[model samples]
Target chain A: DVKVTQSSRYLVKRTGEKVFLECVQDMDHENMFWYRQDPGLGLRLIYFSYDVKMKEKGDIPEGYSVSREKKERFSLILESASTNQTSMYLCASWTSIRDEQFFGPGTRLTVL
Target chain B: SQQGEEDPQALSIQEGENATMNCSYKTSINNLQWYRQNSGRGLVHLILIRSNEREKHSGRLRVTLDTSKKSSSLLITASRAADTASYFCATEIGSARQLTFGSGTQLTVLP
Candidate 1:
């Protein structure tokens, strides 16, 4: 089974603070994605990486960025956290061979 | 923009009963997939039905797809309390690697 792990399951930060969320996958999937899920809004893509050092913005990438320094690791960074940034963040890894995506437990961020 | 929309945003049923949820998408898709998410957790893949296929089943879950109508339905039979969760339908459109997800249906299986 593919296992995706997120650095933190819960986090709290003050406004204007920078935050980092890390995700690691045991399987060497070529694609990784970051999404923020909000009530009524569902899951909106934030950023995705197809390979190391390559990243693309998704639907809602403002105030957020991503890094893929290694094949197994992907990171999401918030340049300046705001209260509106509070959301449940999910990380997923997928490979071409499988149609399904393996997801991490998710990180619930609270920007006060 | 949201590509898929699920009908009956919320559903409640008693255990041993069957629950059905429907999903409708806007564009052509290579495949449609269903996922289950427990409260405050990430989603788990449930089933994937390609555009070429009509129906598929896993365990007690049955999924049916109709390309002409651009809609799909998921039926969970003999539901248990453990089946309580948020169910989402996602679409893989064209050659896009990412999936567009619907808002999801909250299913509560009462014991």
Candidate 2:
């Protein structure tokens, strides 16, 4: 079974503070993604990494960036956390076999 | 955004019954996938149907995809209380590594 693990299950930060959400996958998948899930908005992609040091902006990339220094780890960074950024963040990894992704348990972020 | 959009935002059904959800997208896709998410948990992959395939089945779950119409449907048969969760449809376009997801349909199976 594939396992995708997030660094934090929950987090709280003040406005304008820097925040980081980490994700690691044991399967060494080539595709990793970060998304924010909210009511009525579904899972909107924030950023994705296809390979180490290669990143692409998804539909919703404002105020957020990502890092993929290694194949197993992907990190989401908030340059300046705002109250509006508070939401459940999910990380996912995919391989070529199924094209279906395995997701992390998600981190509920609260930016006050 | 070329994301899939699911119909019927919420659904309630009695246990042992079947539940069907539909998803529509705006562009061509390489494959469509279904995922289930329990409250406050990560998503679990249910099934995947490629663009060339019309229907596929796994256990009690059935998925159908129509590339011309850019729509898909997922059916869960003999659903139990444990089957209750938010179901989402995701589409992976050709050459795109990321899957764009739809707003999920929340299903409640009553015991």
Of the candidates shown, which would achieve the greatest DockQ relative to the real structure? 2
Residue B91 CA displacement from its true place in model 2, Å: 0.7
lDDT of 2 by residue, B11-69 (tens): 99999999999999998888899999999999999999998999999999999988888
Off by over 4 Å in 2: none
CAPRI rating of model 2: high
Model 1: per-residue Cα lDDT over A33-95, one tens digit each? 999999887889999999999999999999999999999999999999999999999999999
TM-score of 2: 0.97
lDDT of 2 by residue, A17-61 (tens): 999999999998999999999998899999998899999999999
Top candidate when judged by TM-score against the true structure: 1
Worst 10 residues of 1 chain A by lDDT: A35-44
Q: Pairs clashing in candidate 2?
A: none
Q: TM-scores for all candidates?
A: 0.99, 0.97
